[model samples]
Target: MRTPIKRDDLESARSDLLATAVGWFKREQDVVGIFLGGSVAAGSADAYSDIDLRIVVQPEHHLHYVERRREIPTQWPGFLFNEWLPNTQHCVSHFQPFGKIDIFYYDAAKLTPSPWYRLQIRILHDPRGIVTDLVKRSEELPFLVGESDVDLSISKGLAAAHETYRRAKRGELFYAQTLLDELRHHVMQADDWLHDRTPETTVMAKFDNRASGEVLSSLAMSYCPCLDEAILAALSSLARAYRNQVLALHEKFQLSRPLRNDVAALDMVA
Candidate 1:
Protein backbone atom coordinates (compact mmCIF):
# COMPACT_ATOMS: atom_id res chain seq x y z
CA MET A 1 0.00 0.00 0.00
CA ARG A 2 1.13 3.55 -0.69
CA THR A 3 1.97 5.69 2.31
CA PRO A 4 0.04 8.86 2.83
CA ILE A 5 2.03 12.02 2.13
CA LYS A 6 2.54 14.57 4.88
CA ARG A 7 1.73 18.17 4.01
CA ASP A 8 5.19 19.48 4.88
CA ASP A 9 6.88 16.79 2.83
CA LEU A 10 4.63 17.50 -0.12
CA GLU A 11 5.44 21.24 0.07
CA SER A 12 9.16 20.51 0.21
CA ALA A 13 8.95 18.10 -2.71
CA ARG A 14 7.16 20.73 -4.82
CA SER A 15 9.76 23.37 -3.92
CA ASP A 16 12.66 21.09 -4.79
CA LEU A 17 10.99 20.01 -8.04
CA LEU A 18 10.42 23.61 -9.07
CA ALA A 19 14.07 24.47 -8.39
CA THR A 20 15.14 21.53 -10.55
CA ALA A 21 12.84 22.72 -13.37
CA VAL A 22 14.35 26.23 -13.17
CA GLY A 23 17.80 24.74 -13.60
CA TRP A 24 16.72 22.70 -16.60
CA PHE A 25 15.01 25.62 -18.36
CA LYS A 26 17.95 27.93 -17.85
CA ARG A 27 20.28 25.41 -19.54
CA GLU A 28 18.13 25.11 -22.69
CA GLN A 29 19.21 27.60 -25.36
CA ASP A 30 15.89 27.45 -27.17
CA VAL A 31 13.95 28.47 -24.06
CA VAL A 32 13.88 32.26 -24.15
CA GLY A 33 11.69 32.77 -21.07
CA ILE A 34 9.97 30.92 -18.23
CA PHE A 35 7.34 32.05 -15.72
CA LEU A 36 5.41 30.40 -12.90
CA GLY A 37 1.62 30.61 -12.90
CA GLY A 38 -1.42 29.14 -11.09
CA SER A 39 -1.88 28.72 -7.34
CA VAL A 40 1.77 28.99 -6.44
CA ALA A 41 2.21 32.29 -8.24
CA ALA A 42 -1.10 33.50 -6.80
CA GLY A 43 0.23 32.91 -3.25
CA SER A 44 -2.62 30.46 -2.56
CA ALA A 45 -0.66 27.28 -2.97
CA ASP A 46 -1.03 24.41 -0.52
CA ALA A 47 0.03 20.81 -0.33
CA TYR A 48 -2.46 19.89 -3.07
CA SER A 49 -1.39 22.64 -5.46
CA ASP A 50 0.43 21.46 -8.55
CA ILE A 51 3.34 23.31 -10.12
CA ASP A 52 2.32 25.40 -13.15
CA LEU A 53 5.11 26.50 -15.48
CA ARG A 54 4.93 28.52 -18.64
CA ILE A 55 7.82 27.96 -21.02
CA VAL A 56 8.21 30.47 -23.82
CA VAL A 57 10.48 29.40 -26.65
CA GLN A 58 11.46 30.73 -30.05
CA PRO A 59 8.95 29.96 -32.83
CA GLU A 60 11.47 27.87 -34.68
CA HIS A 61 11.98 25.60 -31.67
CA HIS A 62 8.31 25.32 -30.60
CA LEU A 63 7.62 22.00 -32.32
CA HIS A 64 10.91 20.59 -31.20
CA TYR A 65 9.86 20.88 -27.54
CA VAL A 66 6.35 19.66 -28.27
CA GLU A 67 7.64 16.55 -30.01
CA ARG A 68 9.89 15.76 -27.10
CA ARG A 69 7.46 16.87 -24.35
CA ARG A 70 7.10 13.35 -23.02
CA GLU A 71 10.83 13.14 -22.37
CA ILE A 72 10.90 16.49 -20.57
CA PRO A 73 9.31 15.24 -17.37
CA THR A 74 11.68 12.28 -17.19
CA GLN A 75 14.44 14.74 -16.40
CA TRP A 76 12.67 15.46 -13.11
CA PRO A 77 12.57 12.90 -10.34
CA GLY A 78 9.47 10.74 -9.60
CA PHE A 79 8.03 10.95 -13.10
CA LEU A 80 5.02 8.71 -13.51
CA PHE A 81 2.69 9.64 -16.37
CA ASN A 82 1.92 12.58 -18.64
CA GLU A 83 -1.17 13.50 -20.64
CA TRP A 84 -1.15 16.02 -23.43
CA LEU A 85 -4.28 18.13 -23.55
CA PRO A 86 -6.19 18.36 -26.81
CA ASN A 87 -4.96 21.93 -27.27
CA THR A 88 -1.43 20.50 -27.71
CA GLN A 89 -0.10 23.53 -25.87
CA HIS A 90 -0.09 22.05 -22.37
CA CYS A 91 0.74 18.79 -20.66
CA VAL A 92 -0.03 17.47 -17.13
CA SER A 93 2.56 15.27 -15.49
CA HIS A 94 1.94 13.16 -12.39
CA PHE A 95 4.85 12.16 -10.20
CA GLN A 96 5.45 9.52 -7.60
CA PRO A 97 6.06 11.19 -4.28
CA PHE A 98 2.87 13.24 -4.55
CA GLY A 99 3.56 15.96 -7.09
CA LYS A 100 1.94 17.07 -10.35
CA ILE A 101 3.13 19.69 -12.80
CA ASP A 102 1.18 21.50 -15.48
CA ILE A 103 3.58 22.65 -18.19
CA PHE A 104 2.44 25.11 -20.86
CA TYR A 105 4.57 25.84 -23.91
CA TYR A 106 3.95 29.12 -25.72
CA ASP A 107 5.77 30.24 -28.81
CA ALA A 108 7.15 33.70 -28.17
CA ALA A 109 6.08 35.03 -31.55
CA LYS A 110 2.60 33.54 -31.33
CA LEU A 111 1.84 34.64 -27.77
CA THR A 112 -1.32 36.73 -27.51
CA PRO A 113 -2.16 39.35 -24.94
CA SER A 114 -4.81 38.24 -22.41
CA PRO A 115 -5.92 38.80 -18.83
CA TRP A 116 -4.33 35.51 -17.78
CA TYR A 117 -0.98 37.11 -18.42
CA ARG A 118 -1.91 39.84 -15.94
CA LEU A 119 -2.46 37.43 -13.12
CA GLN A 120 0.17 36.86 -10.46
CA ILE A 121 3.22 35.27 -12.06
CA ARG A 122 6.84 34.63 -11.02
CA ILE A 123 9.57 34.88 -13.58
CA LEU A 124 12.14 32.13 -13.11
CA HIS A 125 14.26 32.79 -16.19
CA ASP A 126 14.00 35.45 -18.86
CA PRO A 127 17.22 36.13 -20.69
CA ARG A 128 15.57 38.11 -23.52
CA GLY A 129 12.80 39.80 -21.43
CA ILE A 130 10.16 38.30 -23.78
CA VAL A 131 7.86 37.14 -20.94
CA THR A 132 8.07 40.53 -19.24
CA ASP A 133 6.90 42.29 -22.38
CA LEU A 134 4.01 39.87 -22.78
CA VAL A 135 2.86 40.56 -19.21
CA LYS A 136 2.96 44.32 -19.74
CA ARG A 137 0.94 44.06 -22.96
CA SER A 138 -1.68 41.85 -21.33
CA GLU A 139 -2.27 44.32 -18.49
CA GLU A 140 -4.09 46.66 -20.89
CA LEU A 141 -6.43 43.98 -22.21
CA PRO A 142 -9.97 43.72 -20.85
CA PHE A 143 -11.75 40.49 -19.99
CA LEU A 144 -15.49 40.76 -19.68
CA VAL A 145 -18.59 38.61 -20.15
CA GLY A 146 -21.91 40.23 -20.94
CA GLU A 147 -25.01 39.78 -18.76
CA SER A 148 -26.76 38.02 -21.64
CA ASP A 149 -24.08 35.36 -21.69
CA VAL A 150 -24.66 34.59 -18.02
CA ASP A 151 -28.44 34.57 -18.49
CA LEU A 152 -28.17 32.10 -21.37
CA SER A 153 -25.96 29.84 -19.29
CA ILE A 154 -28.52 29.75 -16.48
CA SER A 155 -31.32 29.06 -18.94
CA LYS A 156 -29.37 26.14 -20.35
CA GLY A 157 -28.81 24.80 -16.87
CA LEU A 158 -32.53 24.90 -16.13
CA ALA A 159 -33.35 23.08 -19.36
CA ALA A 160 -30.73 20.45 -18.59
CA ALA A 161 -32.12 19.98 -15.08
CA HIS A 162 -35.61 19.43 -16.51
CA GLU A 163 -34.23 16.80 -18.86
CA THR A 164 -32.51 15.12 -15.95
CA TYR A 165 -35.82 14.89 -14.13
CA ARG A 166 -37.45 13.37 -17.18
CA ARG A 167 -34.73 10.76 -17.48
CA ALA A 168 -35.07 9.87 -13.83
CA LYS A 169 -38.86 9.47 -14.14
CA ARG A 170 -38.31 7.10 -17.06
CA GLY A 171 -35.93 4.94 -14.97
CA GLU A 172 -32.88 5.92 -17.03
CA LEU A 173 -30.99 6.22 -13.80
CA PHE A 174 -27.46 6.30 -15.23
CA TYR A 175 -28.21 8.97 -17.82
CA ALA A 176 -30.28 10.91 -15.33
CA GLN A 177 -27.36 11.05 -12.90
CA THR A 178 -25.05 12.02 -15.75
CA LEU A 179 -27.34 14.85 -16.84
CA LEU A 180 -27.70 15.96 -13.23
CA ASP A 181 -23.93 16.24 -12.98
CA GLU A 182 -23.93 18.37 -16.12
CA LEU A 183 -26.60 20.58 -14.62
CA ARG A 184 -24.40 21.18 -11.57
CA HIS A 185 -21.51 22.07 -13.84
CA HIS A 186 -23.62 24.63 -15.69
CA VAL A 187 -24.78 26.24 -12.47
CA MET A 188 -21.23 26.48 -11.19
CA GLN A 189 -20.07 28.02 -14.45
CA ALA A 190 -22.87 30.57 -14.37
CA ASP A 191 -22.05 31.52 -10.83
CA ASP A 192 -18.41 32.06 -11.71
CA TRP A 193 -19.30 34.10 -14.77
CA LEU A 194 -21.72 36.23 -12.79
CA HIS A 195 -18.95 37.03 -10.32
CA ASP A 196 -16.47 37.92 -13.06
CA ARG A 197 -14.25 34.94 -12.32
CA THR A 198 -12.99 32.04 -14.38
CA PRO A 199 -15.21 28.97 -14.49
CA GLU A 200 -13.21 26.07 -13.18
CA THR A 201 -13.97 22.38 -12.69
CA THR A 202 -13.12 22.77 -9.02
CA VAL A 203 -16.61 23.92 -8.13
CA MET A 204 -16.24 24.38 -4.39
CA ALA A 205 -13.18 26.54 -4.80
CA LYS A 206 -15.25 29.13 -6.64
CA PHE A 207 -17.61 29.82 -3.75
CA ASP A 208 -17.29 31.37 -0.31
CA ASN A 209 -17.01 29.38 2.89
CA ARG A 210 -20.72 29.08 3.65
CA ALA A 211 -21.76 28.43 0.07
CA SER A 212 -19.01 25.90 -0.42
CA GLY A 213 -20.08 23.95 2.63
CA GLU A 214 -23.70 24.00 1.49
CA VAL A 215 -22.72 22.84 -1.97
CA LEU A 216 -20.77 19.95 -0.53
CA SER A 217 -23.75 18.94 1.61
CA SER A 218 -26.03 19.04 -1.40
CA LEU A 219 -23.60 16.92 -3.40
CA ALA A 220 -23.48 14.33 -0.66
CA MET A 221 -27.24 14.07 -0.61
CA SER A 222 -27.35 13.79 -4.39
CA TYR A 223 -25.21 10.69 -4.55
CA CYS A 224 -26.59 7.37 -3.40
CA PRO A 225 -26.10 3.65 -4.11
CA CYS A 226 -29.77 3.04 -4.87
CA LEU A 227 -30.90 4.29 -8.26
CA ASP A 228 -34.34 5.60 -7.31
CA GLU A 229 -33.12 7.33 -4.19
CA ALA A 230 -30.18 8.78 -6.04
CA ILE A 231 -32.38 10.20 -8.78
CA LEU A 232 -34.88 11.77 -6.41
CA ALA A 233 -32.26 13.17 -4.10
CA ALA A 234 -30.07 14.49 -6.87
CA LEU A 235 -32.89 16.27 -8.70
CA SER A 236 -34.26 17.78 -5.51
CA SER A 237 -30.88 19.12 -4.45
CA LEU A 238 -30.07 20.42 -7.94
CA ALA A 239 -33.37 22.23 -8.21
CA ARG A 240 -32.86 23.92 -4.86
CA ALA A 241 -29.34 25.05 -5.68
CA TYR A 242 -30.35 26.09 -9.19
CA ARG A 243 -33.20 28.21 -7.97
CA ASN A 244 -31.06 29.86 -5.33
CA GLN A 245 -28.36 30.67 -7.86
CA VAL A 246 -30.80 32.17 -10.36
CA LEU A 247 -32.44 34.28 -7.70
CA ALA A 248 -29.10 35.54 -6.50
CA LEU A 249 -28.09 36.52 -10.00
CA HIS A 250 -31.33 38.30 -10.65
CA GLU A 251 -31.07 40.30 -7.44
CA LYS A 252 -27.42 41.19 -7.96
CA PHE A 253 -27.33 41.99 -11.68
CA GLN A 254 -31.00 42.72 -12.38
CA LEU A 255 -30.95 39.90 -14.91
CA SER A 256 -34.27 38.45 -15.96
CA ARG A 257 -35.60 35.85 -13.62
CA PRO A 258 -36.06 32.27 -14.83
CA LEU A 259 -39.40 31.57 -16.46
CA ARG A 260 -42.14 30.77 -13.97
CA ASN A 261 -43.07 27.59 -15.79
CA ASP A 262 -39.51 26.29 -15.75
CA VAL A 263 -39.16 27.00 -12.03
CA ALA A 264 -42.47 25.22 -11.45
CA ALA A 265 -41.28 22.21 -13.42
CA LEU A 266 -38.20 21.85 -11.24
CA ASP A 267 -40.29 22.42 -8.13
CA MET A 268 -42.59 19.55 -9.12
CA VAL A 269 -39.67 17.14 -9.28
CA ALA A 270 -38.47 18.15 -5.84
Candidate 2:
Protein backbone atom coordinates (compact mmCIF):
# COMPACT_ATOMS: atom_id res chain seq x y z
CA MET A 1 0.00 0.00 0.00
CA ARG A 2 1.19 3.50 -0.83
CA THR A 3 1.62 5.73 2.22
CA PRO A 4 0.21 9.27 2.19
CA ILE A 5 2.55 12.27 1.97
CA LYS A 6 0.85 14.49 4.54
CA ARG A 7 2.93 15.42 7.59
CA ASP A 8 0.08 16.06 10.04
CA ASP A 9 -1.49 12.66 9.57
CA LEU A 10 1.89 11.06 10.28
CA GLU A 11 2.39 13.19 13.36
CA SER A 12 -1.06 12.32 14.59
CA ALA A 13 -0.38 8.63 14.15
CA ARG A 14 2.98 9.19 15.81
CA SER A 15 1.35 10.81 18.80
CA ASP A 16 -1.01 7.88 19.12
CA LEU A 17 1.78 5.34 18.88
CA LEU A 18 3.87 7.20 21.43
CA ALA A 19 1.07 7.36 23.95
CA THR A 20 0.40 3.69 23.50
CA ALA A 21 4.06 2.80 23.91
CA VAL A 22 4.54 5.02 26.92
CA GLY A 23 1.52 3.53 28.61
CA TRP A 24 2.81 0.05 27.92
CA PHE A 25 6.25 0.92 29.25
CA LYS A 26 4.76 2.40 32.40
CA ARG A 27 3.37 -1.00 33.34
CA GLU A 28 6.77 -2.66 33.12
CA GLN A 29 9.66 -0.91 34.90
CA ASP A 30 11.68 2.24 34.46
CA VAL A 31 11.11 3.73 31.01
CA VAL A 32 13.48 6.66 30.80
CA GLY A 33 12.93 8.05 27.28
CA ILE A 34 10.90 7.60 24.10
CA PHE A 35 11.70 9.06 20.70
CA LEU A 36 10.88 9.03 16.99
CA GLY A 37 13.20 7.67 14.33
CA GLY A 38 13.34 6.51 10.66
CA SER A 39 11.24 7.78 7.73
CA VAL A 40 8.49 9.26 9.87
CA ALA A 41 11.02 11.19 11.90
CA ALA A 42 12.64 12.38 8.67
CA GLY A 43 9.31 13.77 7.45
CA SER A 44 8.80 11.22 4.71
CA ALA A 45 6.29 8.35 4.88
CA ASP A 46 3.81 6.52 2.67
CA ALA A 47 0.33 5.08 3.29
CA TYR A 48 1.74 1.62 3.91
CA SER A 49 4.46 3.03 6.15
CA ASP A 50 5.25 1.70 9.60
CA ILE A 51 6.45 3.73 12.58
CA ASP A 52 9.97 3.74 14.10
CA LEU A 53 9.99 4.41 17.83
CA ARG A 54 12.98 4.34 20.14
CA ILE A 55 12.67 3.53 23.81
CA VAL A 56 15.53 4.56 26.04
CA VAL A 57 16.22 3.12 29.46
CA GLN A 58 18.61 4.08 32.22
CA PRO A 59 21.93 2.38 32.82
CA GLU A 60 22.34 -0.93 34.76
CA HIS A 61 18.96 -2.16 33.58
CA HIS A 62 19.76 -3.00 29.94
CA LEU A 63 19.16 -6.76 30.01
CA HIS A 64 16.26 -6.57 32.37
CA TYR A 65 14.61 -3.92 30.24
CA VAL A 66 14.97 -5.85 26.97
CA GLU A 67 13.26 -8.90 28.43
CA ARG A 68 10.02 -6.96 28.61
CA ARG A 69 9.71 -6.34 24.86
CA ARG A 70 7.95 -9.61 24.00
CA GLU A 71 4.74 -8.47 25.69
CA ILE A 72 4.79 -4.88 24.44
CA PRO A 73 2.00 -4.80 21.86
CA THR A 74 -0.30 -7.49 23.11
CA GLN A 75 -3.33 -5.24 22.74
CA TRP A 76 -1.90 -2.73 20.30
CA PRO A 77 -1.66 -2.94 16.50
CA GLY A 78 1.55 -4.76 15.57
CA PHE A 79 2.56 -6.93 12.63
CA LEU A 80 6.20 -7.68 13.36
CA PHE A 81 8.67 -7.66 16.23
CA ASN A 82 12.43 -7.84 15.73
CA GLU A 83 15.18 -7.10 18.23
CA TRP A 84 18.82 -6.47 17.35
CA LEU A 85 21.86 -6.22 19.57
CA PRO A 86 24.37 -4.95 16.99
CA ASN A 87 27.28 -5.37 19.41
CA THR A 88 28.12 -5.72 23.07
CA GLN A 89 29.04 -2.04 23.23
CA HIS A 90 25.38 -1.03 23.04
CA CYS A 91 21.91 -2.56 23.06
CA VAL A 92 19.26 -1.61 20.50
CA SER A 93 15.96 -3.26 19.56
CA HIS A 94 13.65 -2.54 16.62
CA PHE A 95 9.86 -3.08 16.83
CA GLN A 96 7.54 -3.00 13.83
CA PRO A 97 3.82 -3.51 13.48
CA PHE A 98 1.98 -0.32 12.62
CA GLY A 99 5.56 0.94 12.09
CA LYS A 100 9.14 0.59 13.37
CA ILE A 101 10.47 1.15 16.88
CA ASP A 102 14.03 1.33 18.23
CA ILE A 103 14.85 1.04 21.90
CA PHE A 104 18.31 2.13 23.00
CA TYR A 105 19.81 1.06 26.31
CA TYR A 106 22.60 3.04 27.95
CA ASP A 107 24.74 3.69 30.97
CA ALA A 108 25.29 7.43 31.53
CA ALA A 109 28.82 7.09 32.96
CA LYS A 110 30.25 4.64 30.41
CA LEU A 111 30.02 6.90 27.35
CA THR A 112 29.84 10.39 25.87
CA PRO A 113 27.81 11.07 22.68
CA SER A 114 27.88 12.44 19.11
CA PRO A 115 25.83 14.73 16.86
CA TRP A 116 23.73 12.61 14.46
CA TYR A 117 22.87 9.06 13.41
CA ARG A 118 22.22 7.74 9.85
CA LEU A 119 18.53 7.52 10.57
CA GLN A 120 16.59 10.62 11.69
CA ILE A 121 15.91 10.47 15.45
CA ARG A 122 14.05 12.77 17.83
CA ILE A 123 13.57 12.55 21.57
CA LEU A 124 9.90 12.41 22.52
CA HIS A 125 10.06 11.98 26.30
CA ASP A 126 13.26 11.71 28.29
CA PRO A 127 12.59 11.99 31.99
CA ARG A 128 16.21 11.49 33.13
CA GLY A 129 17.82 12.78 29.93
CA ILE A 130 19.70 9.49 29.35
CA VAL A 131 18.04 8.93 25.96
CA THR A 132 19.20 12.25 24.49
CA ASP A 133 22.64 11.78 26.00
CA LEU A 134 22.96 8.27 24.59
CA VAL A 135 21.88 9.56 21.20
CA LYS A 136 24.93 11.82 21.33
CA ARG A 137 27.21 8.93 22.25
CA SER A 138 25.92 6.72 19.43
CA GLU A 139 26.84 9.34 16.82
CA GLU A 140 30.50 8.65 17.51
CA LEU A 141 30.10 4.98 16.72
CA PRO A 142 32.59 4.06 13.98
CA PHE A 143 31.29 2.08 11.05
CA LEU A 144 32.96 -1.23 10.12
CA VAL A 145 35.07 -1.44 6.91
CA GLY A 146 36.15 -4.24 4.52
CA GLU A 147 38.88 -4.74 1.78
CA SER A 148 37.60 -6.10 -1.61
CA ASP A 149 37.36 -3.52 -4.41
CA VAL A 150 35.49 -4.34 -7.67
CA ASP A 151 36.71 -1.93 -10.31
CA LEU A 152 34.26 -0.42 -12.83
CA SER A 153 36.64 -1.11 -15.72
CA ILE A 154 36.29 -4.81 -14.99
CA SER A 155 32.51 -4.61 -14.96
CA LYS A 156 32.42 -2.63 -18.20
CA GLY A 157 34.85 -5.04 -19.82
CA LEU A 158 32.67 -7.93 -18.78
CA ALA A 159 29.58 -6.19 -20.17
CA ALA A 160 31.30 -5.83 -23.54
CA ALA A 161 32.25 -9.48 -23.44
CA HIS A 162 28.72 -10.60 -22.63
CA GLU A 163 27.26 -8.68 -25.57
CA THR A 164 29.43 -10.75 -27.93
CA TYR A 165 28.77 -14.19 -26.38
CA ARG A 166 25.15 -14.17 -25.26
CA ARG A 167 22.31 -14.43 -27.73
CA ALA A 168 19.36 -12.01 -27.24
CA LYS A 169 17.08 -14.40 -25.35
CA ARG A 170 13.27 -14.36 -25.30
CA GLY A 171 13.13 -12.42 -22.05
CA GLU A 172 16.00 -10.02 -22.76
CA LEU A 173 13.73 -6.99 -22.70
CA PHE A 174 12.11 -8.08 -19.45
CA TYR A 175 15.49 -8.55 -17.80
CA ALA A 176 16.66 -5.20 -19.14
CA GLN A 177 13.65 -3.40 -17.77
CA THR A 178 14.11 -4.98 -14.32
CA LEU A 179 17.78 -4.02 -14.16
CA LEU A 180 16.99 -0.52 -15.37
CA ASP A 181 14.37 -0.14 -12.68
CA GLU A 182 16.75 -1.37 -10.00
CA LEU A 183 19.50 0.94 -11.23
CA ARG A 184 17.17 3.93 -11.31
CA HIS A 185 16.01 3.43 -7.72
CA HIS A 186 19.48 2.78 -6.32
CA VAL A 187 20.89 5.90 -7.98
CA MET A 188 18.06 8.06 -6.67
CA GLN A 189 18.80 6.92 -3.10
CA ALA A 190 22.51 7.75 -3.53
CA ASP A 191 21.49 11.21 -4.71
CA ASP A 192 19.07 11.70 -1.84
CA TRP A 193 21.76 10.72 0.64
CA LEU A 194 24.19 13.24 -0.88
CA HIS A 195 21.62 15.90 -1.81
CA ASP A 196 19.13 15.96 1.05
CA ARG A 197 21.43 14.41 3.66
CA THR A 198 18.65 11.93 4.35
CA PRO A 199 20.14 8.51 5.04
CA GLU A 200 17.37 6.41 3.51
CA THR A 201 15.24 6.52 0.39
CA THR A 202 13.29 3.75 -1.34
CA VAL A 203 15.53 1.51 -3.51
CA MET A 204 13.62 2.71 -6.56
CA ALA A 205 14.44 6.32 -5.67
CA LYS A 206 18.12 5.40 -5.54
CA PHE A 207 18.44 4.78 -9.32
CA ASP A 208 15.97 7.42 -10.43
CA ASN A 209 18.73 10.05 -10.62
CA ARG A 210 21.40 8.12 -12.56
CA ALA A 211 20.09 8.71 -16.09
CA SER A 212 18.45 11.54 -17.97
CA GLY A 213 14.78 12.19 -17.23
CA GLU A 214 13.73 10.67 -20.56
CA VAL A 215 16.05 7.68 -20.60
CA LEU A 216 14.80 6.66 -17.16
CA SER A 217 11.17 6.75 -18.29
CA SER A 218 12.06 4.79 -21.40
CA LEU A 219 14.04 2.21 -19.41
CA ALA A 220 10.97 1.51 -17.30
CA MET A 221 8.90 0.71 -20.36
CA SER A 222 9.19 -2.38 -22.60
CA TYR A 223 12.72 -2.54 -24.02
CA CYS A 224 12.96 -1.63 -27.71
CA PRO A 225 15.52 -3.61 -29.77
CA CYS A 226 16.99 -0.30 -30.99
CA LEU A 227 18.00 0.52 -27.43
CA ASP A 228 19.32 -2.93 -26.50
CA GLU A 229 22.96 -2.01 -26.83
CA ALA A 230 22.48 1.19 -24.87
CA ILE A 231 20.62 -0.64 -22.10
CA LEU A 232 23.32 -3.29 -21.83
CA ALA A 233 25.96 -0.60 -21.67
CA ALA A 234 24.14 1.16 -18.85
CA LEU A 235 23.75 -2.06 -16.88
CA SER A 236 27.44 -2.77 -17.23
CA SER A 237 28.27 0.71 -16.03
CA LEU A 238 26.01 0.38 -12.99
CA ALA A 239 27.28 -3.07 -12.10
CA ARG A 240 30.82 -1.75 -12.18
CA ALA A 241 29.91 1.34 -10.18
CA TYR A 242 28.11 -0.71 -7.53
CA ARG A 243 30.91 -3.28 -7.36
CA ASN A 244 33.31 -0.58 -6.18
CA GLN A 245 30.66 1.21 -4.18
CA VAL A 246 29.86 -1.99 -2.30
CA LEU A 247 33.47 -3.07 -1.85
CA ALA A 248 34.78 0.30 -0.70
CA LEU A 249 32.12 0.54 1.97
CA HIS A 250 32.66 -3.05 2.99
CA GLU A 251 36.34 -2.32 3.49
CA LYS A 252 35.73 0.84 5.48
CA PHE A 253 32.56 -0.12 7.31
CA GLN A 254 32.35 -3.91 6.93
CA LEU A 255 29.00 -3.51 5.12
CA SER A 256 28.48 -7.03 3.84
CA ARG A 257 25.10 -8.71 3.87
CA PRO A 258 23.46 -11.52 1.86
CA LEU A 259 22.69 -9.62 -1.32
CA ARG A 260 22.39 -11.57 -4.58
CA ASN A 261 25.91 -11.92 -6.01
CA ASP A 262 24.81 -13.33 -9.37
CA VAL A 263 26.04 -10.84 -11.96
CA ALA A 264 25.02 -13.38 -14.62
CA ALA A 265 21.43 -13.13 -13.45
CA LEU A 266 21.43 -9.58 -14.75
CA ASP A 267 21.84 -10.99 -18.26
CA MET A 268 18.90 -13.37 -17.81
CA VAL A 269 15.61 -12.15 -19.30
CA ALA A 270 13.48 -13.49 -16.44
Identify the leading candidate in terms of lDDT. 1
True-structure lDDT of candidate 1: 0.77
> TM-score for model 2?
0.47
Q: List the residue pairs that clash in candidate 1.
A: none
Q: How well does candidate 2 score on lDDT at residue 115?
A: 37
Q: What is the TM-score of each candidate against the true structure?
A: 0.81, 0.47
Best by TM-score: 1
